[model samples]
Target: MTHKILIADDEPNIVISLEYLLQREGYAVLVARDGQEALDTIAREQPALVLLDVMMPHKTGFEVCQAVRADEAL
Candidate 1:
């Protein structure tokens, strides 16, 4: 099955790299800069998986993960 992966990170290089790699693997890639954007994207798309960086702006990856896990919509 085709799956979508959300990559949340502040670094543009990291985002681009992950997108390229994951896309090459035939997965749809969605990018988010910083934790808030990541959360927003997750709420909007409900991607199959996520790659979150630990030290992001607005909120940390730890916070984001906790929030995502706590989200009933997920």
Candidate 2:
């Protein structure tokens, strides 16, 4: 099965590069502009891996990572 990867970052440049790299590696890509959106997407999409930015609006990457770890599905 193809793995799903989430790219969570407020910076367009970083998102673009990561999306491209992940896609090139044959993984499905999902994107979020902020930490809250990342968490929501992670819960909904259950991405196999999350590429998160440390500094973002609403919630930080650390917070998002914590939430993901706390979530049983992820």
Q: Which numbered prediction scores highest in TM-score against the true structure? A: 1
Error of 2 at 16 (Å): 0.6
Model 1: which ten-residue window has the lowest total lDDT?
A: 9-18
Candidate 1 local lDDT, 6-48, one digit each (tens): 9999999888888999999999999999999999999999999
Q: Tens-digit lDDT track for model 2 on 1-74? A: 99999999999999999999889989999999999999999989988888889999999999998988897886
Candidate 2 backbone clash number: 0
TM-score of 2: 0.91
Q: Please, what's the RMSD in Å of model 2?
A: 1.1
lDDT score, candidate 2, position 73: 81
RMSD in order of candidates:
0.9, 1.1
Clashing pairs in 2: none
TM-score of each: 0.93, 0.91
- The lDDT leader among the candidates is 1
The local lDDT score (0 to 100) that residue 48 gets in candidate 1 is 95
